[model samples]
Target: MVRESLKILLTSCFLLLFLASCTLGGGKNGKLLKSTGQPYEVVLEGDTDSIVTKILTEEVPALPQPEPLCRLIQVKKGKIHGSYLLVRTRIVVNIPAAEFSVGLSRNENASPQTVIRISARSPQQLREKLNPEKLRQLVDEAELEHLASIISTNPSKQNREMQQLVKKNFGISMNIPAEMQASKKAKNFIWISNNASSGMKNLILMKMKEVKSEKRAEEVNSEERRVKKTDAFSAQEKQQIDSMLRTNMPGETDSMYMVIPVLAKRGLWEMKGDAMGGPYVMQRIRRGKTGDEIIIIGFVYAPEMKKKILIKQLEAAISTIK
Candidate 1:
């Protein structure tokens, strides 16, 4: 009887341990549930009135219209157990602790997940110590990671041939989607586009020699500007960029060309002598150790649809620069 009792206790313990391990691993199947929600969407929990929500939902500066940096769905702490656990990104605030602190965890309950938790002895301390910019940076990094994962996992969605061509010409790797066909290619320039009827997404790549004068001008402009640091362009900088765009990105007609309008808002691009205009993002990066610079511009022509998400997706594609 003593031996039988010992055997039963051992069996129960083993079973309990196995069940606990399975739960921690996400489920009995030993697989994590795929994260849910659209890109840049985040599930926010805990104190709603805190700066966390404000920063997450704040309008992105210098855009043509109001658009939040992240789409947020609020939830109470008790409600974060089931499907909420599968959200791609989450932020929790005001948890009780000895002192103010912030913590981050990845893939805790689901794959491709980012969970940020803020703790403090009191709500006041949490608010006082929290750095809004730091929180924003964390959220941005999480969203970018989520975007990169999406692009990397789905080979069918990416245009490998175009990416390879970019590598051959510029010696840089970029993940271009299969939907964007190479519309035009020239000496050190390539134009790729989706060519959709409802809306179109375009990307331009150009390799140019780095000029010391341009670098000095940028530094001078930076020192002279009294406004807060933003992506907005100075008048002289706008003219220089516009000239470069016109020389490379010409329109169908001889008289028409691409230009950044004087009244153009940040990230806006328009075609001269034409009615076509949309949002654009441009980045100039040094090409390896060479003196050449690679110019990447992503633009969208979606007049009818909301452009916030579309521009962000384009940004993600551009970010694949390696």
Candidate 2:
């Protein structure tokens, strides 16, 4: 008997069919229970004699409020279309069933770097039903933050770094190695690898993550000032810009489109293609007539990312992004 137990795991932000397992029951004495020929709910009506043993044997995490389920999955008898947010990473996940919904909040009390806060209670239910061990391998904010922490957020007073020294401007700090390269091109700031480290839980050092491409003078969502200026990029120059957006970003990377009002209006895409995955990363940059451009930063993970945790973790990481 095939019981409809749909397991939809929401690891990070990406959605994959992780154990879309259909639990089944009935057929005692090799006989069907009902011939309604429709999906019917199964209720277990039995004595509670073994309640104490079952409870004792059941797996209950010693986490504070179930650890926010690094992954959130919702499986109805079939599939329930919905959107769930990975609060810590801020990735908004939407399935075919629902319009875009963006109501996700991180648990200030969670205090776990890798934790993902799911918005809907359904996802919470999904999280509760699934096995916990299945989630350990996926990358989560806790891991990324752990990786980010290994790097020195403070920049060394070194001169002539590949990346112009960003004077700790963004109040938010990251674990960038003092030796890791840095550059500040215009309003945007970038950091790259100078040394590789194994313990780096985040993808930064693994060469799995990097600035796939950076766009300048191009406008995204806004029209460029059409002043009588010959310095405007030519058509062929524009194709080079268009080609940038040919592929989807790896699931691990986030596409950040920034609008710098005073200095320079621009959009930036960061792509990290982990070699473990099919490819490195693809940064898709496109152009708009009004000087606007769209940057798609993709992190294509190994099919392993398709796992609930990686998808949700990447989704969570992407969600935290603007």
Candidate 3:
């Protein structure tokens, strides 16, 4: 367990620093500003039932995204700008040395946003969690001083080709990082079927995973129905939920905590672990979606002194998953 914590600490160090979709800059060749040669405004509105997919092709990857956690959903068209009446499911996966999130955005200033953002964070939380006293014993002020830059920076960026799609879900973009190399890219985001997992990691990912039109529509309908119910905690109970949201500094994430949609049913409260040097704390906050009878799933980890800074990074990480 102690040795595992050390590896997690190193992972936290690498991933949190690779912030995606939130950073900025692209000098030439759209190097920093990923530009795809595709048209910007997609006006097709009839039955807009289409699929979106993303695949990865890389060797010796630093981290691997969990399969089930990554998925697609078609959002209502009008919710986002210049989007077809359809949207895809959005998800983010955190792997050692990588803080990754993917999705489409609607209100973003840019159009056609099928992008990827990665970031890095402090490993202080990991060491503190693994062995607070031992960490203190093994490392002195000199080592602590070297970690200054890694903790203060955010490194989000834009993936040019899929910007249209990404913008519809994630709503924002970042400048690509100069430090990391392009691991790989897929010709089409949606290509393979459910059985695609038979191939090696990169092969499976590089070829987008496909879902049948009927099944995709069914999932979307089920999702909508889930969100259509209109009941919530009583007036007094909501006050309590509000009370929790108002407080909670959540030392490890961004300032945008507990912002559930005002009119949806079945609100979600989430906070997940940072996989620091030790077990991460669970951060929980509950709020109902104004009127949808939807079952919400969340990922919130509690706050702990060991992972003071690292928790915030992971918090920021999951916050991007909507």
Q: Where is model 3 poorest over a 10-residue stretch in terms of lDDT?
A: 199-208
List the global CA lDDT of all models. 0.75, 0.27, 0.27
Per-residue C-alpha lDDT of model 1 across residues 1-322, encoded as one tens digit per residue = 9999999999999999877765633754576767888878888988656568877788865456688888888898656777777888988876677888899998887888898988888767777898888898898878876776678779998999888888898788888888888477878788889989866898888776545477544643554432222344446555556666777788898789987554332378888899888887776664333456566788888887767777767778887777
Error (Å) of candidate 1 at residue 7 is: 26
Could you give the candidate ranking by TM-score, starting with the highest? 1, 2, 3
Candidate 2 wrongly placed segments (more than 4 Å): 1-139, 152-160, 165-176, 179-278, 282-322
Which pairs of residues have clashing backbones in candidate 1?
none
Q: Tens digit of lDDT per residue, candidate 3, span 71-178? A: 233334334332222212111221233432222333222222222212223233222223323322222221222222132243333224433333332232322222
Clashes of each: 0, 46, 88
Off by over 4 Å in 1: 1-29, 213-241, 261-266
Worst lDDT run of 10 residues, candidate 2, spans 36-45
Better of 1 and 2 by TM-score: 1
